[model samples]
Target: MANNQNAELLDKARLLRHDIRDGSFTGYTSGLVPGLVQGNVVILPKVWAEDFLLYCYLNPVSCPLISMSKPGDAMVPALGADIDIRTDIPQYNVFKDGELVEQVTDIEQYWSDDMVSFVLGCSFSFEEALLRAGLSIRNIDLDRNVSMFETNIATAPSAKFFGNTVVTMRPFKPADAIRAIQITTRLPKAHGAPIHIGMPNKIGIEDLAKPEYGDSVPVNDDEIPVFWACGVTPQVAIRNAKPPLCITHVPGKMLVTDKLNDELAVL
Candidate 1:
């Protein structure tokens, strides 16, 4: 019954991710796998992983860790029974010396014995919840990546990993924004409530139209820009850490997990 239906839905999402890895599908994964939990992937050397884990613990709002694999373990059974960290994600961004060097669908060639993979909760799961509650996510409605920017808000520092938090913005009317906050607050694993609302400049975001990452959605006159701490914030920390090598899922192309969105609800 209910479990079987959930499994079926997750299977479909896994298939979609498989297609993405095989090049049959290469696009933003938002709204594609509804009801399933999607995640931001971070693969780093075991040497750097401990500090990164501490960073997540310190800044849970932006880096809500869902699961982590042992050094060199590619299969994260906790996320999906069949998940292969090397190929399960839709896309991966490779960074060297803190610079993005390339983007690829799979990372089998790059996998190392010292590598460890981490999966963090993504905002997409909560956005799905909002949609189910009859709230409109401007970026989803416009078929774009939610606007993201580097905020002035600093994350709680972990040794060797410290940077300003990055936030994703969605425009909603005042009432809808308040309701959205309430609904999202139930899912802390997926960013929970927004960090700031109504004032973009107050957060150090100069122009909402020019986002640091992802596509920009038009903000209607009646709506205000509401911001949520983003999973991508870790990438900013990675840049600050300047690890010899780091890998992450390309923004908007998350790892679809077997877990249900409802299963992650706090209340």
Candidate 2:
């Protein structure tokens, strides 16, 4: 099912996952595996999984589920046969009762038999698509983390998981922004389309220099900020819900999986 490019990309995923598992790769995973899908990781106990699943269903843009492992299972067979949720991701954010208590390179000690791991499609998938289409992503080009912010836009609530939407911003020239929009619209599984463009203040973002999550890069005057619903939206919901225990990928760090970007395209 993989082309030569995807095979090369998958090899990168394996190597990157190995590095992450071994505590060598702790930085944000951007532009690592060019074609393989990278995902936002969320882990929760079975008692809390249902509500989160409902939240994901109610808010597809913010929580696009690519694959979810069964309760008590660590391997995500759909994404990769050997994915060990406890260590494959570069970093994990541990939340306790709505607060981020710790961040670690691995969650082996934190893993429990009743835990369920959810892997949501990431913007990295469509970023690759954009790059192939000749669009330059500011974050990647500058080698900095993408800018993400919590917006005033509220996600449709499901159970106790309620919070405002989180968005990732990328700057582009107007014409290139239009083409980027058309390119990304084809990958619904990768958060489909841009939710806002041009003005950050309109979306409750007061400062472009300071992002709520990830590193903020310089935005050129000739370029406009384009925003997309981020997978971090679920993490924000988890924080609001204040579950007893929750684990998520550290903002920009993601789980590299074997799926191809085009494989997730809708049209």
Models, CA RMSD each: 1.1, 1.3
Tens-digit lDDT string for candidate 1 (1-267)? 987888789779778867866778868888877899999999999999999999999999999999999999999898788888898777899999899999998999899999999999999999889999999888888899878899999999899899999999999999999999999899999999999998899989999999999998999999999999999999999998989999999999888888899989986
Which ranges of candidate 1 are over 4 A from the true structure? none
Q: Residue 200 of model 1: what lDDT? A: 93
Where model 2 places Cα greater than 4 Å from the true spot, the runs are none
lDDT of each: 0.91, 0.90
lDDT of 2 by residue, 171-250 (tens): 99999999989998998888989999988889899998899999898889899999999999988899899999999999
TM-score of 1: 0.97
Candidate 2: residue pairs that collide: none
Displacement of the residue 72 alpha carbon in candidate 1, Å: 0.3
| Candidate 2 TM-score, true structure as reference | 0.97
Ten-residue stretch with the least lDDT total in model 1: 17-26
